[model samples]
Target: MSTMGNSTNIFWQESPIGKLERQKLLNQKGCVVWITGLSGSGKSTLACSLSRELYTRGKLSYILDGDNLRHGLNKDLGFKADDRTENIRRVGEVAKLFADTGLICIASLISPYRKDRDACRAMLPDANFIEARLLEDGLHEHVRQEIQKAFTSLHVLERLKIFSPYLDLISLHSRSYIQPGFTGIDDPYEPPLNCEIEIQQKDGDCPTPGAMAGEVVSYLEEKGWDVYQQASGSNM
Candidate 1:
C-alpha cells in the first residue's frame, strides 16, 4: 500500500499560476493555425507537415482535424447548416483552450463557411491567427490541367492564388457540408488582413512543404515566440 504525503487537496483556491508561467513551460509562444480548404485540398497535409516542424523545434502544438472531431467532440452533429455552425463553434472553443494553455492549436477543416471561421477568429486574440491557402483543384487530372491553363493566364504569383475557382468546385461537390457563402456561394474569402503569416502556394512540379514550414516558423519567431527567453516587450 502507498501512503499519501503530508499534502492536502483543496476544493478551490486563489489563482496561483499565470498563462506566462505555462508559456514558459511550453517554451514557444502559442497561437492558432486555422487551415481551411476544399476536400482533397492539402489542408490536413499541410497541417501535418506544420506540426512536424513545430515538434522538431520543441514547440508545443496539436492538430484538430475535422474528421477526428466528428468522431468524438462533435459526434452528434450532422451536415446541416446549423450543425456545421455548431461544429465550428465547438472546435473553436476547444482551440481556445489549447491556445490559453499556450499550445499552438492547428485546425484542419473544410470550414467552407466564412461566418463560422469568422466566429472562431473573433474568439482568438488578434495576433494568434495564421492562415494558409492550399489549392485542391489539383486533384483531378482535367482540373489540374485547367488550373495549369489558368496559371498561364496570370503571373506566376497569381497562379499560386488559384484557390478561388477550386473553392467553387468544392462548394458544388460538397454542398451538403458547406453552408452557402453569406455573400454568394461563390463569395471570396477575404485574405487575412493582419494575419501573422500567410503560406502562399509555390510554383513547380515538386511539393515545397519544407519551405512553407520555414515560413510558418519564421512567422512564429517574428511574433515573439522565443522558447529560450522570456518575452520582454509585448505578446504576438
Candidate 2:
C-alpha cells in the first residue's frame, strides 16, 4: 500500500494474464499510436482511417477521439490548461490499458502542450509509444506569422500581459482576435521533435484518407508490430 495523489493506502493489483499472453491471443504486439495536431487538422479522420486499415488487415485496434471522450471520461474537465493536462493524462492511462490488451490504441487529440504529450509517452515502453503528427502544409508557417504579428503590437502585448495571470497566454492572445484558447492560434502547439511518423500535405494538397492510413500501416508493418509469431505444434 502507498499514497498516490489524493488517494491514500492504495495498491497496484496484478493481473493473472500478462501482456504477452494477450499479444499471443491477438497475434500482434500491443502499442499506442498517438495522433496529435490542431483542430480541423484531420486527426480524427486519420485515426478512423488507420483503424479501418488495420481491421482489414485482421489486426485489432481502438480509437480514442478527443471530442468523443469529452462526452464521458473527461466530461468533468474544462478547457483550462490544468484541465487539459488532466484530460490528456486520463486518456493516456486508458490508452495504455487498451494497448496492454494487445490492441493498437489510437489517440487523436489537439494535445497542444509538449510536456503533457511527453508524459503520456513515458507511460509506455519507448518503442510502444508511436507519436504521429498530422499537419497541413503551410499551417505552421501561417500560425507563426500570426503570432509574430500579435507580438509586434504594443497594445496587444499590454492587453495580453494584463490578462496573463487570469488566463493562459495563448488563450489571451487568441481571444483578442480569433477563438480563445484555440490551439495553433493562441495556444502554442508543440510539434514532436522526434516523432515516429508525420502525415502532412504533399504537392500543396493533402492525400486521400486511405493513403494517409496506408502510410501508418506501412510503418507498423516495417517495425514488425503488425503480427506475432505462432508457437510450434508438433502434434499437428
35-132 per-residue lDDT for model 2 (tens digits): 99877677988999999887776778899999899999999998889999999999999999999998899999998899999999999987999899
Candidate 1, residue 222: Cα displacement in angstroms equals 2.4
Clashes of each: 0, 1
Evaluated at residue 4, the lDDT of candidate 2 is: 73
Q: Which runs in model 1 stand beyond 4 Å of their true positions?
A: 1-15, 140-200, 204-206, 227-236
**Model 1, position 124: C-alpha lDDT score:** 83
lDDT tens digits, residues 1-236, model 1? 22444546534433677667888666566688888765555667778888888776667689999889999999999766788789989998898878888898998887767778889989987877666555443343455455445434443434567557876565454444334342112334343444455554456342577766666767677767653243343432
TM-score for all predictions?
Answer: 0.66, 0.79
Model 2: per-residue Cα lDDT at residue 226: 47
Quality of model 2 by C-alpha lDDT:
0.82
Clashing pairs in 1: none
* Runs with alpha carbons beyond 4 Å of true place in candidate 2: 138-179, 227-236
